[model samples]
Target: MAYTLGIDIGTYETKGVLVDTAGTVHAQASRGHQMLVPQPGWAEHRPEEDWWGDFVFVCRALLQDSGVDPAEIKAVACSAIGPCMLPVNASGAPLMNGVLYGVDGRAEAEVQELTNRIGEDTIISRCGNALTSQSVGPKILWLKRNCPELYAETSHILTSTSFLVQRLTGEVVIDHYTAANFSPLYDVKTQSWVDDLADDILPLDKLPRLLWSDEIAGHVTPTAAKAAGLAPGTPVTAGTIDAAAEALSVGVDQPGDMMMMYGSTIFIILRAQSQVSDPRIWYAPWLFEGEHASMAGLATSGTLTHWFRDHIARDLDPAQAFPTLANEAAASPPGANGLLMLPYFSGERTPIHDIHAKGMLFGLNLTHTRGDMYRALIEGIAHGTRHVTDTFAELGQSPKRLLAVGGGTKNALWLQATSDITGIDQIVCEKTVGASYGDAFLAALAIGAVRRQDISMWNPTDRTITANPTADYDTAHALFLRLYEQTKDIARDIG
Candidate 1:
């Protein structure tokens, strides 16, 4: 039986899956890694150890556990947290740690500098995106200015998925969806790199060849095959960033389909009918040519709850801490008992692209308990999601179907709170194994084993979280909007 292998390198862990054409997951594996913070407002990962290391370990574990022969695995694909910036040396060796996604605010000054030089309106007109922490062009300038010696040595720059693909196949190529995030350096209308914009930032020839996510990039090299425990000539697809693959896994095919990814960050992706120009949200050419995508993300979500667990819930057992905290949060009444939080621990994105923004806990009283604070944190994230959804609707492109996925989908209280705050029903899938599973399906498509629509059959809808609005949350959400505006400057000062 022909099989496909998929792997995803995520914020906190790497996950892999081995599956056949029939949608049966033969085996799965995961490995944990740390996100490094060398300074304030910066996050990095050691690519060699964290990315390729996890990939190697997971592949061996999956093959051993499943008892599957390597020759039977027909195709391979990978996805990772991206559109990150990683300058590499002549031989594709990383010159520095990979700068993570919008979570790292190290390029705030570069964002402002580019916007001032190019004008925000002109940027939107050219790239269909406003200069924000999410853009890679600014980050490249940051590297050039801050680390001149390293930048001078850089032969090429790559995102996480691009790095992995190059390591596997010796083919330096990036997917259209991920390449579009290099705003100011990519042309949304032309669907190719913009030398006029990129030459000003860095070398144009350093950029990777672009391909659709399902297109075969190249076959695995003999050296890579030995390291990754795969056959010598297995075909590898041009994998995308993790979120796009996750959205694909859940059958977000049509224009109105959406994916709400509740991981360390709350990411939202909506399939678009056509190219959209929105300053409040980022737009990109979709995984395939001619397709379009609109994306929004909060800098923090599950990360906030994680902070509370490690710092506040210190008394609970480590293994049971999350569930225990969830139960406590559930016991608290809605509206967090008059407490409200701004989930801006890492700063804000999407609707409010403020890098200097800081978290706020408003109306905290002496009577409040740990549970109330936890509930407020989750509610704040939901409010941010609502803001993004509202932006889409105001632009006349609200998603008709919302699919929920990721680790946080298992948290009933958190998922329900998001539904109550947003007033949009969310559908959970039967197998929401996320991006790795999506990668496997993409591998199947690349090798002609399955059609594009077969994903709906592989992962069926489990249930829906219908909207159940409450007056308490309505009042809190109203305050949520007002609180941000009122304290914008104060948050900046604090940050």
Candidate 2:
């Protein structure tokens, strides 16, 4: 029987899994990695050290643990935290550490310059997006301006997944879903890199060739085969951004189907039959052809929980402690007794698009306990999800049922609060796998073992819980909006 291998590199760790055509995971392995915070509001990773090295280690680890022959593996696929800007030299070595996604604020000035040079309306019309910190165009411009020497040496600019795929197969390619985040750099209308725009900003030839997510880009080379314990000439597919893969992992395959990815950040993807040109939301091609997705993201979601655990619950073990915290949080009533939190610890993305937004805890009282604070944090992230869902509604592509996936799906309070605050029913999958599992599924699709529409059969889950917002909770939500509006200026000022 044939099997496939999937690997996912995330901000905190690298994970790999081995699975057969039936979707049953045979073996899995994970390795923790460090994030480089050289300075405040800056996040980076060394592609050689963290990205490639870990990819090799995890693939070897999976093979050894599973006792599966490398010859039996038909293909390998990878998914990674994306829209990362990594400058590479002619020899494909990293010119410098990768500047991470929207949370990294190193390109603040370039964002302003791009926004000023290209009027917001023009950018929205052409790129299907504005000059937000989330888009990769401003980040590329920032590299050219801030690090001239490094930019000059850059032979190619690649995202996290593209970087790995290049190393594995010697093919430089990126999928449409990942390329869309580099708007104004990629021509969304023609589904190609914007040549005119590239001449003005980035080098056209340096961009990776764009391909559909499931297309077989190349075969694993002999060198990579030796390093990864895979056979040479194994078919490798062009994978996608981690969130898109995670969406696929949970069976988000059609219009009215939405994916709520709970990870370091909260990613909301709503599918559409046609293109959606919304400046307030991100526009990307879905995993398959002839489909599009309206996307929204919060720069910080699980990060907020990490902060609370680090600052508040330092004495407790994270694995067990977070559950205790959630239990305590559940003890409190909805709305955290009027406390509202703006979960912009890193920055705000989607809807507001404010890179300078700061985290705020509003209506905190002297009478509150640690549990109340915990409840407020979960509620805060839920409110952010509500904000994104509202944007989906405005775009005429609202989800009928929100499917929750990732580590955050394990938290009952967070999931229930998400349902209650958004007033939408959420389905939690029984066997929730993150992006790596999704990448393996994509590998299966590439080999013609499964169809895209058959994803629901592989992913099955019962409704664990349904939460309804109370009248009082509705009142608090209204107040939550007003609180953020009043503090918007103050948040930016402090930042």
TM-scores for every candidate against the unseen true structure: 0.98, 0.97
Instruction: Please give, for residues 167-246, the per-residue lDDT of candidate 1 as tens digits.
Output: 99999999989988898988888887886754668877888998999899999899999998999889999999999999
Q: For candidate 1, give the lDDT of residue 220.
A: 89
Off by over 4 Å in 2: 469-472
Whole-model lDDT, model 1: 0.91
Residue-pair clashes, model 1: 0
* Model 2 pairs in collision: none
- Span of 10 residues, lowest total lDDT, candidate 2: 464-473
- lDDT score for residue 284 of model 1: 87
List, residue by residue over 210-286, the lDDT tens digit for candidate 2.
Answer: 99999998999999898877899999999888888888888888787888999889998888777888767888888
For all predictions, the C-alpha RMSD in Å is 1.1, 1.4
**For residue 337, what is the lDDT in candidate 1?**
86
* Clashing pairs in model 1, backbone N/Cα/C closer than 3 A: none
Best candidate, lDDT? 1
TM for candidate 1 is 0.98
